[model samples]
Target: QQQVRQSPQSLTVWEGGTTVLTCSYEDSTFNYFPWYQQFPGEGPALLISILSVSDKKEDGRFTTFFNKREKKLSLHIIDSQPGDSATYFCAASMSNYNVLYFGSGTKLTVEP
Candidate 1:
């Protein structure tokens, strides 16, 4: 199956807390790893990404830690804020560069 499964479709965190989202894939050929973030009534944007060759990627408050050997990955948001409250989708692809398998998305609300 070409499905990338994610858990806890929603998460609530404090403004100064940390949030974690998880994802797993069944595609053995998957190569591209991308994390998209979205806000209310907006399109998803590429927050951070890592090639299958890399295991971790960090960009400021957002970080993606991947385990290619285990077919699993996670996105961590440090010092989450109300502005960070949105949907996080973990996606995977096999170099298709067009069709990306996206998780259902986790809705995170950071309380201030």
Candidate 2:
């Protein structure tokens, strides 16, 4: 069974627009939420993360929000550019372990 579920398998956005990606998890034990960005040939890199204790986290133009009660999380990209076009994966993990449960990912395209 899939522990984490992500919506909108693919997405398209115009340059300088906002991009929103969401995900939900079945496990309530998940404490750490991380969003990863991957290019065509490169590995996924940690973009931003938030702990269950916090409601939101922001890094530059990227922000991640977590709802512990609802077991839902979202990643928001403001002023999205062509360089931000990539596959984004939402993952959940416990605070004590390194294991991660990842969603299928959302393919994002930023049209210039």
Q: Write the per-residue lDDT of candidate 2 for residues 34-77, one digit (tens) a residue.
A: 99999999999999999999999999999999888888999999
Q: For all candidates, what are the clash counts?
A: 0, 0
Total clashing pairs in model 2: 0
> How far in Å is the alpha carbon of 55 misplaced in model 1?
0.6
Lowest-sum lDDT 10-residue window in model 2 = 63-72
* Top candidate when judged by lDDT against the true structure: 2
lDDT scores of the candidates, listed in order: 0.90, 0.95
User: For residues 1-112, what per-residue lDDT tens digits would candidate 1 score against the true structure?
Assistant: 6499998889998899999999999988989889999998999999999888888899998889999889999999899989998899999988866689999899989999
Query: What's each prediction's TM-score?
Result: 0.94, 0.98
- Looking at model 1, report the run of 10 residues with the lowest lDDT sum: 1-10
**Native-to-model Cα distance after best TM-score fit, residue 107 in candidate 1, in Å:** 0.5
Candidate 2 residue runs with Cα over 4 Å from true position: none
